[model samples]
Target: MSSETRNTANAPRPTASEPAPGSRPTATRRQVLAGSGAAAAIAFTGAFSELFAGTAAARGHGGYGPLVPDPDGLLDLPKGFRYRVLSREGDPLRSGEGEVPSNHDGMAAFAGRHGRVHLVRNHENRVTAKIGVPTVEGLTYDPAAKGGCTSLELDGRNKVLGERVAIAGTAVNCAGGPTPWRTWLTCEETEDRAGTNGYAKDHGFVFEVDGADPRRTGAVPLTAMGRFQHEAVAVDPGSGIVYETEDAFDRPFGLFYRFLPARPLGGTGSLRAGGALEAMRVPDLPDLSSVQETGARFDRVEWVPVPDPLAAGTPIRLQDFGPKGITHAQKLEGCYWGGSSVYFVSSFARSDEGSAADHYGQVWRYEPQKRRLTLVVIFGPDTDIQLPGESPDNICLAADGGLMVCEDGGGAQHVLGVTRRGEVYAMARGRQNIGTPEEPEWGEFAGVTFSPDGSTMYVNCYTPGTTFAVTGPWC
Candidate 1:
């Protein structure tokens, strides 16, 4: 998409008294602090103020607990916690035919009866040789093909109650958002291709699956969500608006996008039938190519709306606004909707020399009311703020009001927690080496979600894939 397209969607307007659809009701100052638990946590860590001197200053209110790495070939967390292997990359297919695939990324949990929860998770494999094709118990997959989805049931104790494959022949299943209606939107991040064997038209669309039924088919791709290298999705519950991030690290990419359902509150059961896909562009920075090539920082940002988001699927170029006003730091990925603002993180940036920015990652917040964007955090290649380059993937909000960032950078991969006050703490470090892209140890921590009550945390690894449950004293 073009810069003009992006800006049109994010144009700033005068602040209005009326809040956005899902904006929380205004609370008294005392209520806000009491609700956040920030003050109490800070006070509990009284010595934290002294530790906040230099790089330690960045370690906000929360501190790291002991790491309980499990080498027994099973996932484990803190002492009070326990985890079950909900699913694995190459487990025998419940469909009674093939095997489950690998590269699991994002996932969502839904409440089930009797204290059970249903999980709908994504497999990011693009039908490769190493990992064979995915097929459900009753379904079938060509031996040569791969890529699919899975559904599983876990009880309160984090034990896998049941498991099954939902869809197959998909590709690059990345981070997807959950709809207010409770279905999981599994996104395929690649365009379909026609080969000698047949046409694979299931790629590059959002497919909604029944979170409860793993064997149930009827998985339909929502063409309205746009076809791109999708990374993550965040939804505004009241408005039913879906905000999505694209993982286009290579070249010619667009900005973050928002989809307004054509039926307003529609798409509960079907996403393809309705919705207008719009890409964001900053009107102030109309000429992105020139700005990026010249290495100029266009501090002013705006959101422009895209006229034709689905035009990408057609042969003709739709609304081509050449790279102007766009920045090299445009690879928008990992977004979570929270705190009256949308928090997003960029994986990395390409420097003026065409080399990747060293430890260049930014956490940005989008204020819907002001239509404003702010740079909340920037990481450098130092010890305190050290970040794996090119792999800052998924993020989740902590009960303590901080961010749980899943680092995807090779060897430096880790699950880092960044508090709202700007303290960074390593929650869990991947077993992978920092500089090499060897098969990620501890897998790439992508999918992260807290239980409804915010007591337990669930994390997933993308390669050598496994899901872990981490519980602690939130009370």
Candidate 2:
């Protein structure tokens, strides 16, 4: 069961509950945000202008350390780290499973037998697959919905053992969260309703998939979690609450929400049973501009009950909470459950995206314990979106308590790292071009995550999709 020799016609598929080293660890919301981690989050420069001393459009040099360009030009990693292309957009499978799907977006790593791991990978496909992971009968909801997830096993050396479709026939499976109960929550990055986008049913929703499920359970949409252009989710183990991020790029902006499950701590399949979806509202913050000032801190924030969880026509942002001050972000994308808080990335606020106020990017830390959300690591206009380490998207916590952020902004994409000391570094930079002279590969990196034991890191190249696994003597 090796990556290179995976062309066997009848290779045994790896089980989701396949035993491994140890289950991934979890920390309480308070412990994650209490001391040093909280201080480090605040100092990351969410005060856009003050941190960089200017704007992203005008800024100079930034990045934790120097990126030694890879000789192959596919990725520029720091000195000690190295990466391997685990799966390509169109590689044929070894077990006759199917070709690796394109549009790789969100992903999670679950333990496998003998120190191995299972990566539940998502594809952000909007239309029917011209060419991608096909619809599996038992796993598909709508044949026309070309988006879904694929599960693959990785062994000790970080090589693919086998690949198979986990969930099938959904739409725009963007980014999702890894549940404490050992499952992946796949999110849809679309608001295109059923009849409008040629979809048989409403599109925006979240589906859960267990990597160890020896069988596919089909598409299970957790409607109670709300319906909109969902980007990602971060779970709070202590309280069965699921924090969700919306990727609405409109001027009105996207809302940060949390779903309170009706069935407390019901684990993976809990949301579908029912829950109360609520949007975040800060006391004094009305517009998105209030946080654009950099180093802006909003304490004592509360959740506003969403008027309509299923935002069919008028999204939750425009519903009742709009006037009540539901704080909005330019484009909320990737979010991770940081030990004591939830760390989320707000992809640059640009006027082009209908935003009056624009920024390179901003990272925020939401401390549920204190009812506070702090603005951290803000890039001004001077910051270079083209250079690397700007406009961050999908994020994951490192074993060392640092943050791994996928650069989704512009120029050459990179996997950026943020230390507890509030320092930002280029962990890995994309090199290979997926497009031709007319459209050379300029894809942003997504699905940044680490293996359970923290020996390896996995990330995705969004366009002409591809996934890479990097191993190194992590700092």
Candidate 3:
């Protein structure tokens, strides 16, 4: 997602008559919530009412909402809740290892013994001056700068039980989801050729890490998963199928993809052995050039398997599914598999015609069973929740059944919460000056997760590189 959409203030608004993608005759939102345990509880009576009512009340002030303050700056939340910092950039990796890498991104949490939780996090830095060069002992990549992954063990109090670096010397480390077998898939979001940095010889694929042993070896790139600007990944436990999103910011839009692992419940070693890669295409809408030109909207989502997964070595082109005959959209970032649906976000679209929908980013939901795609929410070129700027990066399901978005844009970045009913709220704002005069405010929040009990929420800042654990009455 890019912040350029916020600069255009006079774009034409979208009319109700415009055909919205993923538009169903009936309400699909309710069905998604009804199917999941956490969603059912929050989308229904108890928490749902509170979230909506609070949001409606908070909107009366300026465009900004009231702050859900945390005194320790650990975690900010609504009333009757608190938070603490679980980890920070530059913190010691473990007792004697190196320091925690900067630019922390996506993360996943699993149950640990003695009432502790295990977390595997990503550092989305291709190259940075502050972190020196990125390097791993055996891996042939830069060794001084940024771009790495880490695993941590924390107790109920959000105290660090143990921590260590899992992998390093990667590029543009971005968001990835969890697998059913209890492992974390850290995605590398760059297509820089093999020798550019030595880390990406056959890189730009998803890597699996054992949450239990972060220091264990055998971390290999899964080349079978395809190589493009990889963003986030979601796996279907029942089918052992993996869905991926591309974050291409250039002219041609990125794509949504899926990989069916050759072997089910395969070891956490690599993605090379099994499965086939497939790009999603809309069967109904074959041509998208006219749609991109006229700014029309349509719902077209169908999955087509790639005949050869190895074809990833070449520049992979995605089929267009937009209305008016279809033109590619840019940067297909932020994705998650939940409530029997694949949810994804498109950062921005260039609009020579000045269409509102073009400048605004969109949240799309794909129902595999129905073989359909729908646009659930649209954020305009502004700072408000509904009118969010471009660059909607990573997303996670809140304890209250809403969506938590990390705004990776300029001008007062924030962590936004969007409800199931399509309402948006600012859960937290970027702190300008934490404690230093020269250090700028920490923005670009990525990687969000909640404890299994749903009592605590964890968030990470990609720039200054910080992680905080917030606890509240989210449910």
lDDT of 1 at 11: 20
Residues 318-398, candidate 3: write the lDDT tens digits.
432234233234667888777667777765555563222354456666666555565555444343432234467788776
Better of 1 and 3 by lDDT: 3
Query: Which model, 1 or 2, shows the larger lDDT?
Result: 2
Q: Sort by lDDT, best first.
A: 2, 3, 1
Off by over 4 Å in 1: 1-60, 68-82, 93-97, 136-145, 196-199, 214-217, 286-307, 312-319, 322-329, 352-359, 382-390, 432-442
RMSD of each: 10.7, 10.6, 10.1
Model 1, range 140-209, lDDT digits (tens) per residue?
2322336656777777776676766766666777888777677777776665544523434535667677
Q: Report the CA-based lDDT of candidate 2 relative to the real structure.
A: 0.71
Each candidate structure's TM-score, on Cα atoms with residue i matched to residue i, is 0.75, 0.83, 0.76
Where in model 2 is the C-alpha error above 4 Å?
1-66, 128-130, 214-217, 322-325, 381-383, 435-441
Estimate candidate 3's RMSD in Å.
10.1
lDDT of 2 by residue, 320-412 (tens): 765556778778887876556777778778776677667767777777766656665665343344555457788777655566778776566
Task: For candidate 2, give the lDDT of residue 188.
Answer: 87
lDDT of 1 at 87: 61
Each candidate structure's count of clashing pairs: 29, 32, 27
Kindly indicate the candidate among 2 and 3 with the higher TM-score: 2
